[model samples]
Target: MKIKSFEIFDYESAVTFWKSIEGVTLNESDTKGSISSFLFRNPGLSFVAKDNNEIVGTILCGHNGRAAQIYHLAVSNSHRGQGLGKELVDLSLSKLVEANIPRCNIFVYSNNCVGNKFWLKNGWDDPTTWKVLQKQLDV
Candidate 1:
């Protein structure tokens, strides 16, 4: 298994991996193209983990050169419990550090027990630094 940054070639594999989630309600499959386009226009900021030529996990890292946001972490079902998710996170941070990014953050839904536990176990804590505000956009 090898963990590597995102490539234009990995888009289809990434989509397949994402589409397998049966429990979560994500946007329909139509967004795959937009997602790939976003990453293609902004490289070195996201990653895809593959094993035996299949995408097993993915991570999206946002950038400002000072801090980065880790989001959209997804690991294929069969690949769970193999540390691929953690490896994806580590690789993103490693790349950010190499580029001189000083801080990073990831926002997981508070109700997601496993995600909360994972972040806690990984030493993610910065309550005062994050704020949640929203506006109702007229539809």
Candidate 2:
């Protein structure tokens, strides 16, 4: 499999891959329009792993000026253990470094044991000093 920068045209395959991943969350905010906007804003930070024209893995990354954030890091069931996830993350981190972003973070659901384990195994430390909070806003 080859890792490549994500393109707007990969949306369908990416969405299908995300749907197949057990821990991936596809919310109302993750529509095609939202994804297009996100890609427009954070070009070259996200990536996809493709094998024989099929998207086998994906990682969405972007920075918020001060800190970088990773979203929807996933690998196909048949493609796990191949280090694709780490490769994608490393690529994103390199991009962040080039942009002078100081740090990076990813949100993992408490129930996503697999994701949590992957993050920890990849040397990501969880900060116990802070809590994550969010509120829905009406637009």
The digit string of per-residue lDDT tens for model 2 on 1-139 reads 7899988899989999999998999986688888888888999999999999999999999888999899999999899998988999999999999999999999999899999999999999989999899988775
Looking at model 2, report the run of 10 residues with the lowest lDDT sum: 27-36
Per-prediction TM-score:
0.76, 0.97
Model 2 vs truth, CA RMSD: 0.8
Extract clashing residue pairs from model 2.
none
On lDDT, the leading prediction is 2
Residue-level lDDT of model 1, residues 1-139, one tens digit each, is 8878787677676667766754323443226675666676557878887789887778877676677887668887788777787888888888788888899988677676666776787778859766878675553
Candidate 1 residue spans exceeding 4 A from truth: 22-37, 40-42, 126-129, 135-139
lDDT of 1: 0.73
lDDT of 2 at 33: 89
